[model samples]
Target: MAATAAGLTGSLLLPAAQAAKPARPLVIAHRGASALRPEHTLAAYAKAIADGADFIEPDLVSTKDGVPVARHEAFLSETTDVAKRPEFASRHVRKTIDGVTHDGWFVEDFTLAELKTLRTIERIPQSRPGSARYDGMFQVPTLEEVIDFLAAQSATVGRTIGLIPELKHSTYFARLGLPLEERVIATLAAHEYTRRAPVEIQSFEVANLRMLREKLGKRANLRLVQLVGVGPVKPSDVAATGGSLTYADMATPAGLRAIAEYADVFAPPTRALIPLKKDGRLDTPTALAADARAAGLRLVTWTFRPENRFLAADFRDGAGDDARNEAGSIAEMRRYLALGLDGFFTDDPALGVKALAG
Candidate 1:
């Protein structure tokens, strides 16, 4: 059966007291209901909550002024109007970052006031035409604004909405002398969410997670997470190659154990959890789950959208990616639940919510 609508039977659907219960495989919104709206915007986050997501995930990047904002990249070229603004043409500069020389409008070059003039756009237009409608509708939002908005939204909705903020390019932010961990911790702490409320901080680098644990102090209830991908380089290489935080660290039992020392969760890419066959069917994922559990860590995989159905497929052959995906989504969610995952990231929260309790 489909899950009850959020407001229709809010109490019956997921009892109020149940909010305090240890989350059982939560359906986290990756940048709000990104499938429905432009990611990281207030509109997207609002839609995620209305669509029944338990948490809204945001990637935090610093502006030129060192102010934390919700954005996936330190550059505005791909997802904002910065490139089109003639006034900021002089701001474009080429720099080698993560191994490649990028010539574009970098976020660090613009102050919060300047960045606000540019509006957000869809990160991937090919997959989502509807999202393009929101192009130029939202300005870069500060983490403070996002936090306050969520706090007020939760009280009004009569349901809890968790936050998962990632410290993007921590090393870079540090080089700029902003020290992302301190800013993130201060922001969450100011909201009384550091330990009392539901919130988690993630980073692709191990050193950053270590820094968070150290700087936040042991008493701080902040949970740290390490995001792993299939890339071969370590966190050390990310600043050099711009490659993902390597799976080389995540796949090893020792790596997981080290992560558990400071991190409560490990959000590996869905590929790490469920290997896709050449024909695009999902293989079993228990091995990876068991490894994380053995290290006293919880697994939280990411980006489970209908378009990425091959990673969730149960059958070798299937229909089109979109049409064949719903079944794959349900099956993959169930499989991950069986593996004792603490949570997962998705662009579609409606299906994810249903799959959570289905």
Candidate 2:
């Protein structure tokens, strides 16, 4: 049977009173305070909490020893100095992840102790050279460590901070005998973050989320977010029915309703929610926000960075050398906030906090 928002009951739907939009949308520090420090490190997360971010996002991948760690992808070359370590140079290998071939040092190939030896480097050094200065300064952190740090931060700040951990490449990991859902759930349960904590598990795949929902059962009050990418959906995403479903399919009313059955939130790229028009300005807001809300789902968006190349042409300031415009990014964020988005993921949490306040 097709799912409908009206059919949802229990914890799925928020009361009408609680559904009202807030004065300020949530500022989620994407990969900690990634714009200032190496992503997924303790320093980045600490800086994010200090900058007034309501939530800190960690993309979780597992080490060979079955420990959940914070990394943007299972592949290590892009964000870590794994390639330079001569001792582990033999670990470089090619593998297919979620139907795409990746050649690098994957996280699953190393034990926790071995993985910790490598230091994080800024993924986009050209755009964020300041972040590159901290390369080789911090070790990759475990999921348990991140939870403990946030718990301590929450106590010190006297306010509850949230954790949004994305389970990266679930199916691929599962195929490799390292399913992330169980590991993540076990970690959260061990840390006492399973219930009544501001924690959300996000993923691009659908089946794993359903599996997680089953694992959590009736006590799953923590938010579940379905992350939509730009391209068509993968075979793993629709493995049940032997049918094809794109991310665009998930944005429709019916798809939103279906997602609402298991997920509490829908997080898509900014372009998916608001595409650029021919003139390079943002076009009319898509019905995604409204449809998602109507389907008893909250809306959040991702990866807001401050660069002229990323900003809309209208939002951009003077061209050429003056490309990295913070003002343009803030203005763009403000426009999205005005659309009543529940939250947004940004590399610069402080800037997001300031923009939302303004």
Candidate 3:
């Protein structure tokens, strides 16, 4: 029972009655227990939900037929068995994407029918061996299918299972003539996943955020998140450097204010929000979070995975290896959630729910 907040397009608060409820921060499965399952498949999401994740994250891409699909790479070479198919050998052409020339199987190059015949594989073999078993077990899921899955999962779980869909390589998608905002909104509307639904749309591009502001109108019910990162350069310097420059522009207060004009949330890596020094342990929380909040934007940081917990010098270093330490992670989550964060994204939502429920 989350309560609605003023100036908020979507609800991110627990009901007042539940406000006093002691809880840990949210644990969002980065890609549905992705550490174990091939990312973005129903199997992964299902496992995440079962493992206690409150929300399932799906990095979005599109199909040949203009259907939005859950995928990390626009090409199938990394995570799918597309390389094994001789039929697509000729189809594997090179294209310059995101300022880089990549030669492989592009999603836009294949129709859904063609893609359906292929199987998914482990994107990162060095870290996960169990995921390879799921190779080719599931087809790339359309965003619409994912929305439908969320609705059904919500009904089945008896609790709303939220979704955090990131708009990946939006500039590339737009350049290809498919404006992602419209497609996303249409899918959300068609699926009835607007502000009232437990879904949030996020993107790393500022231009994309501006486009969303225009498309959704001033008072659209959907919540918009501006994904940023911390980098070395000053905001002005980064902007001047221009096209495809790193996210350094987003770390400055000025850049954050520009984003706050349209977005309700600012999502940055946890380390950026709280940097650590050589002495170990973090320096005080940076001004970026405060600045974003001052601009009336909710500051949400995440992917606070145990692997990233090496900063707290006094904390046990081994905890990073224990991804399932519900109690320990909750404590870590509390440190951030207590900062008046609007929401969070974790690969372990169970920890968030557990902490919040506490």
Candidate 4:
């Protein structure tokens, strides 16, 4: 018990000069202060960096021309003005991605030039009315644009900001002849800043992370993170290949040990670390944190949002589900931090900063 508690912090032996500064958990901005700004925009990334995020996340999807763009998913209907654009009305089509069939305009169906003509919008407008007001105000950004923007933001902020880009639906993209791994790597290598700065490539799929580990080798500033899903869910890649490995299997000590062979970090949804009870209050802490460390993996989770809907029951108040309860949100995070996370993702990085401050 003591060992698990101690190891959960991921405290490392540092040189005497560095030992004076305690290692704090990383504050990762989930889609760039997405609680406020239209996600995956320069405005959102800027807000996150300004609010003191150690890393900003960009979920990568490829366009028809094979260019990687920052978006939450391959589908464009929820997060863009594509549905309202007259020229793109004919582009609507149904396609099965990772087993789910959706009828809508997909990023993979549009070229980068065509995609740039569309603007970003809030995915959940009812919960974030303020963000919805900025609908059609920001352009969908390419990975190159995001990298360049991060480089510029780093210079202007006088701090070393980092990038954590997740290769969304890797298997799906690979099937479309628009495989993202090499293109993303090429883009990263092209940028001088990305070459030197901290770049963590994340994915829910296993093959891509393994491939990245083999192709990139080990780098001082680069890490490969494996994002775990809930329950017996199999990763898209594993599912596509008809493999039987479930995320539940991956959460096991043996599974994590296997993951440690290729990936630097093991990240799952927050509940996987500490599950909630039937009543919505937090249940007993799961052994996931301890198990990951036992397997030689760094621990992290996604995400922490400021709204009551996303808060743990212990933190939510009389305020409705959509209400943004800053105090409750911070409290929820602090409770989880007590379990000794190496890092965490949050929709509002300012609150993450505040939660870390104490």
Candidate 5:
């Protein structure tokens, strides 16, 4: 009987040990398997978790009621069926956001109840018709809902699923008397995800990230990431804050070091890692990755898709097909992985998982 009990204990231990095996170069689902579902919906996030993503990324914007919701931008026209809703016709108006003029239904103009009347549609139907089929089928999800969904999924799957919520247009929202930092922090804290939770708050604006660090203080230990945009920083971005630093400045070694002070991760566009040549083919890698590493920051790149348009010319298999070329995407991911990237924000997390495995 003792011998039988020992064998049973070893068998149980084997499954636990196998489950603990580490996954390298984490796969973050950009907008939650967005290539397969309407972005920012519960369906999208659930699909991403099912596909084995390490984290589900939600870009957060606030409704007029000040409820934080998952949306790529404050503008709702692009991803929602708001245009078809005749009741909201007068709600459509032009407004300047972060120095750019946008004409549409702004999230900040509608209360959460009004906003819930709309359903999500595929943001990029031209590239992903398969995803578009589910359009008008999924409702927009709030950040709180997303956190709850992830928590429920974690319990069901017997594994911890992470969340990386990007605070969209912090400065713009602050100007509208709806600063995102406080709302995000309050939501996270309310959920008891303040300490040691698999959550990271990210932002494109620098001042807000600094503000967030101060707001969280030493009481809550949440990770922060600074997303770097392409090209020279806009003059408006500088003028808005009366700061001299541009995105170009932020990509420099000095800028990375500054980021390391407040942020745990530096996520730049893929081009920042490997620049494109004159012919649009991928050229040699830049020093950003190495510089980021030197500053004690983990490097993650964004928006890895399988389409020819998004892929480097060398990776594209002619221009006719919109469907993802799995082989080509995997090859490109492999090239990026060779640079020792810490993680990737991919539309297809399953592909990322397979590429990282090889």
Candidate 6:
């Protein structure tokens, strides 16, 4: 088995009563086994759980009827078969989400029944031919349905399967009267499984997590994750409120300490922890993991994909960039795991599981 990271190992030494058994760095499925399956479907999530993921991510967007459904973005063109359907051709239009104007069918314009008719597709077919094979085979699943499915999966698998639900575009959805925070809480509470399951609610925004913390207080099974985006982009909530706070500011020690007031986890993109040199090879690591731990927050990172294109130069093979390179991906993941990270998200949980198993 892979050794526990020094950063996380110290956390495990908390009094036995103060902490549960050792939580080996978690392997969270990024949009299910997304590198292989059309993301956000039951099939994708089921595959992730089977591949030994500790948590499955569901990026939540809202419907016209105000139901929260799984999607990478509110736009329907990239990940669904919406464009191929003539019946909904009129639904395509330009809409602004977090300042970016996307021309497509927005999720907020479709009802649950309407969305049910649209099947999910691989967002990038050229890079993920395997996932494209399953495109249009699975319907969009609701948060309630996802919880039900996870409940059944957990029982069958004989372990607690957790959920890491990202609240997508909090400010944008709120302005449209399809607020996500309340709906997520209501849906989680309504499910017998999610009520006790390890649920980590994450968001790129600031205010909503603070709001959620104020409303829910602290539950042993519930945690909030603050996702730090790269660069100087301000959180949507912050921008909406005319605040100048950017993700960079939040990544600082002071900001991380503040985040500890409302969140248990501090997650940034993988490169933020280990930067890539101008040559695309791995470069010196930032003090992010140590800084996060210093602020009493567990550090996690996003996205390790089993493709040469996404791998750092140190791990890539001579094979063209788009080719799947499981070996390279696993080696890259292990390198970061050695940095003492508490958890990470990956597009292929099987690779993540293998990397952790040593």
Q: Which predicted model would earn the best TM-score? A: 6
Show model 6 residue runs off by greater than 4 Å. Answer: 1-22
State the displacement of the C-alpha of residue 10, model 5, in Å, after optimal TM-score superposition.
40
lDDT of 4 by residue, 1-358 (tens): 1122122112111111211111789999999989999999989999999999999999999999999999999999999999999998999999888777989999998999999999999999989999999999999999889989999999999998989999999998888899988777777776778766777889999999998776556666777899999988899999999999999999998999999999989999999988999889898899999988888788899999988999889999968999989999999899889888889999999999899888
Model 6 agreement with the true structure over 29-140: per-residue lDDT tens digits: 9999999899999999999999999999999999999999999889989999999999999888998888899998989999999999999999989999989999879999
On the 0 to 100 scale, the lDDT of residue 324 in model 2 is 64
Give each model's whole-structure lDDT. 0.74, 0.81, 0.67, 0.87, 0.81, 0.88
Report the error of model 5 at residue 300, Å: 0.8
Q: lDDT score of model 5?
A: 0.81
Let me know the TM-score candidate 4 reaches against the reference structure. 0.93
Q: Encode model 1's per-residue lDDT on 1-358: one tens digit a residue.
A: 1221121222111222212325477889998888778989998998999988888988999887878899987877888988789999998898765444778988888889988899999987666668878998988789989988888888888987888898887777777786676666656655543235567788877787886555443332346678886657667435454655466756788878877887788888777777777766666664788898899887788877755433444632355543435556666666666767788898878778878877
Task: Score candidate 4 by lDDT.
Answer: 0.87
Which window of ten consecutive residues has the lowest lDDT sum in model 4? 12-21
Give per-candidate clash totals. 4, 0, 16, 0, 0, 0
Question: What is candidate 3's lDDT per residue for 180-288, written digit by digit as tens?
Answer: 6666656665554444455557887677667666644444234567887567532222343474445666667776777777777788888777777787765777777
lDDT value, residue 77 of candidate 4: 97
Evaluate model 6: give its lDDT.
Answer: 0.88
Alpha-carbon RMSD, each predicted model:
8.1, 5.7, 6.3, 7.4, 9.0, 6.8
**TM per candidate:** 0.85, 0.90, 0.80, 0.93, 0.90, 0.94
Candidate 2 residue-wise lDDT, 29-146, digit = tens: 9999988899999999999999999999989998998888999888899999999999998988998776668788999999999998889998988877888899889999998899
Error of 1 at 98 (Å): 2.8
Count: clashes, candidate 4: 0
Give the Cα RMSD of candidate 1: 8.1
Residue 225 alpha-carbon offset, candidate 5, angstroms: 0.3
The better candidate by lDDT, 5 or 6, is 6
Better of 2 and 6 by TM-score: 6
